[model samples]
Target: MPDLAQSTFILPQDATLTSEQSALEQRIWAFINDNHNTTSTHLLIISGDAGAGKSVVLDAAFAQLQKAARATSGELAGTDNKLLVNHNEMLKIYKEIAGTKSYFRKKDFMKPTPFINAYRKAGKRADVVLIDEGHLLLTMPDPYNKFRGHNQLADILQLARVVVLVFDFHQLVKLKSFWTPALLKRVTRDYAVTHYHLTEQMRVGDAAVNDWIDHFVRGKMLPLPHPQHFDFQVFSDGQPMYDLIQRRDAETGLSRMVATADYPFTVLGGKTWYVQAGSLRLPWDKINFTDRPWAQRPETLHEVGSIYTIQGFDLNYAGVILGPSLGYDPSKDRLTVDLAQYQDKEAFKKRPDLADTTDAKAAIIMNAINILLKRAKHGLYLYAADPALRQRLLQLAK
Candidate 1:
């Protein structure tokens, strides 16, 4: 357990933007104003890596949109605008941010499914719609999510005059919501399309270490560079790392341990479950019953988080416990993934049209690792379940 108490809500970053971010927001605003009443729809795809400040830019631009929607004058005056996100945890954070602002309403933020279904039934179209974590939008009918539409993005395009989407290819983790750059291009080919690729890296502070992480995510095993502005450490054992994370949590706040879903557990098992590796043992992130995110919850210090709860969020120091599904192939002198060891079956669900599921399975697991590894803004703590993999990372750390 950590010295930090059960948590308070971590609000979105302040509404300030760098010059580059502000210029992008200005372009987005102009597009919305220009197309709000146009006969044809338009799309602006904001592409970036994780922690590239795409969400931050969107929030700033959306604040201006909301202001115009409720205003009495101006081109955007009385126009309708909505913010959409497919991730529940992220949705909670956005709505919380809305609730705190006088000009904003919680209702302005919603999931893509309900928003699409409601507006279509009401025979209404929006002036503009902004989607965060657009990579998570269902690309096919997912009846379980109450989304029976062929594709959520397509549905939104039909119901909006202008659509702005925050997308990252590396964040695609599930077969149902799988997306690729080619697929994105094909979908918006008929629309008046523009793209803004964010160049800034907002989370990790060190450039060399950031490069190492990028190579790791792409399956190119190489030496880890010595970091100047970042704290990067590798641990052969998880328990000691857990202690350091707890200490960091006490000093800095918002620090927690998160792992890939490589252990045996089910959401409906109706029993207490734990993640155990050697002498390190702890419960998985508790089923989040509060509005605060799993990492923001005070009790989460004692619980290991998963991709479901931690994606699209940031922390001061993220203690990453690499799980069993990942390993190293010393023979091939590279990293490897064992799909059988991956515990999240939902991520590997059969997609009828998906070719090369084997490759995709490995990619999804690596994607989860990428999301976990980049959560820390200042430092990162690390542990690996497989001894061979741990040894490989240790060698690279040297």
Candidate 2:
């Protein structure tokens, strides 16, 4: 297997931080400096919505911490003393900004028994661990992870002296993800936990567009009262929407098509179902891992991506396909989800209390759609799979 820490990509230094980001960076530094030599563990949770600039703040902090560690000739004055874990694509971005020497996946850090055993064998423990997309941290045990812990968060807290987690609870789209306020409090009972919030929008510039997105994602059936600066459109068909995206990509770059897993497809054997919008037929792209970037690849333009591939990334324009699973009630003027048409197998697994109830399932589907809708920075082009829904969107567009 290839070493995960080694990367050739480097992020440009021109990314500027907003005021909120600058304040958060100072606080993170203060937290690290205060707890540098603490015997017990400390946890700092930075919570923010999408486009809140968590990654940018952390990237800047990482660079500063690295510089500080280099200047000091102490036990923690090196890269090995700190560890950074995130999704593969996120880590790649960080690698470009900070370089690759201390990167690991969340799964690798969650196997506490093995991680600790190896560390003990080497006679060292990590001083700090930085986690991005902390909501995506898994709690479920699998064949590869035989860790003796309740969840990944617990295991990570045990392995490091100080842990910094950047998370957004709303982005919890997976079944096994273990990020809730109650869960966080329960797991961090033994550690000193500090919470910080990031509020400024960094990805989408228009506040009206953000508000409209929030309203739509919350299952509002009302028509969007057009925003001033954002460019949002609803198309009757998918081909024109895709054409707009392709044109935008050619002109400005970072535009792609994404959708929910409403169609039938095989994960293995490289089989895929086509998303048809009138004369348009496009293959749905399989779920790509954190290491493999679907949106950044040129071939992805010809494919439709799911929430898994496009989440945590920003685009200039996004062409979204609201598949058959999600529908519109013309009589009620509200959004509805058909549980039967929903095809995300992992999302179908429900908690014992919510078993057999469509409420939870519907919420997940809506959340997935919300995430897809908010991905575009400057523009959003949408096409509903159901004719009724398409007609409704068209009426709203007019």
Candidate 3:
């Protein structure tokens, strides 16, 4: 069996914006502050690939907003000043608010309309409204009419002189209409949008890892290996990866370990140990339902085949059981792209220019693997169940 130690948590640092970015932030802030008189709506949508420091830039911008708010005494003349961060922290804040109400509970916070409206109403004097994970607003399946079309979160954007939706559309792929061509056109056409393509690699500590991710995403990516001790093995089989994860060396934290989240899904036998299902879920609830055994099963039984469960998250050492669905052809030593499995295939198809971008697909998988690999501070063990693939990995190791 493949073995990999449990991975550790990565606390992202605040990204520092350059002077040019500072100017843009200042301009956006000024527009927000001046909105009361302008009566014109302003929307600023920030898009980037995952791990491109999108959150860091937003954090910096929000920090500026806080400073400006304190300096101007929170009254931006005609602007309504507000800042909302998504991710785990936003959920926590919502939970606290839900606790005060009889009808609202911790679980109800996922439908964040009540909490959002309340926050907006209280911060009327504010001119700028920022939603870090604004994409989530679009995906929310709430029956509440307030979240509809113009009355929806877009209304809040209209209310504020300046509204910022800081997001990586890549992460929102699970949502419908996330990266649709029409939506892409709207983003490019509407508002004074600024495209900040972060070319630097900071998240991955190793240069090879960074280079590999770039190469995987956009095949043209050049390697920039670090001098650090590291090894990469490509296997024809899937079992060896599992064996590596299970390998333990007590001297180093390299000893085998297993990690679990407060969320569901158990890691067993060097692969994600979760109940099987025919399809995956959308948000948190999706995983809960899909894990039900009563759900239809595919002709073949392989656990690590789904990228939806694997992407955007990491494990200490991953024994990825490359399934046929992903078009893993060992003889060719090349991977094929399949858009059907995409979280938002319709949206992806709408962006026809990206239709042939193999880099984008590889980058997604490589990045997911990177997330899993980085979880190992010591070493990563590669394994494949197929004996030929396992032997290939062993040969690659040498």
Give candidates' CA RMSD values in order. 2.7, 4.5, 10.0
Per-model TM against the reference: 0.95, 0.85, 0.54
User: Which runs in model 2 stand beyond 4 Å of their true positions?
Assistant: 1-12, 72-76, 79-86, 95-124, 144-148, 286-292, 330-332, 350-359
Q: Which candidate achieves the best TM-score against the true structure?
A: 1
lDDT of 2 by residue, 1-398 (tens): 22222111222345456778889999998999889688899999999878777867776676677666665575447534443543555544544333344432223232234554466567675777777777777655533344444477787787778888888867777655634577778888989999999988866757877887787777666565577767789988788888999999899777898887887776778667877765678998866654546677777889988877777777788888888987877677777789899788776655553335455566668778877887877888888888888888888777
lDDT (C-alpha, whole model) for all candidates: 0.85, 0.71, 0.41
Q: Model 2, 337: alpha-carbon shift in Å? A: 2.3
Give a tens-digit lDDT track for model 3, residues 114-222. Answer: 4456656776423566666565454333343254332235445544556666655445432322344365445436454444344443334456664554454332323
Q: Candidate 1 lDDT, tens digit per residue, 1-398?
A: 32221232232244357788888999998878777788789999999888788888888889889887888887777777899999888787787777678778998999999999999999999989999999999988888889998789988999999999999989988988888777887888889998899988878888777788898877778887767778899988989999999999899888999999998777886787889765899988766766777887777899899999999888889899888888889987777888999988898888888777887788788899999998888889889899999999999888
Worst window of 10 by summed lDDT in candidate 2: 1-10
Distance from true location, Cα of 341 in model 2, Å: 1.9
Worst lDDT 10-window in candidate 3: 1-10
RMSD of 2: 4.5
State, as a TM-score between 0 and 1, how close model 1 is to the true structure. 0.95
Give the clashing pairs for model 2.
10-96, 11-96, 89-290
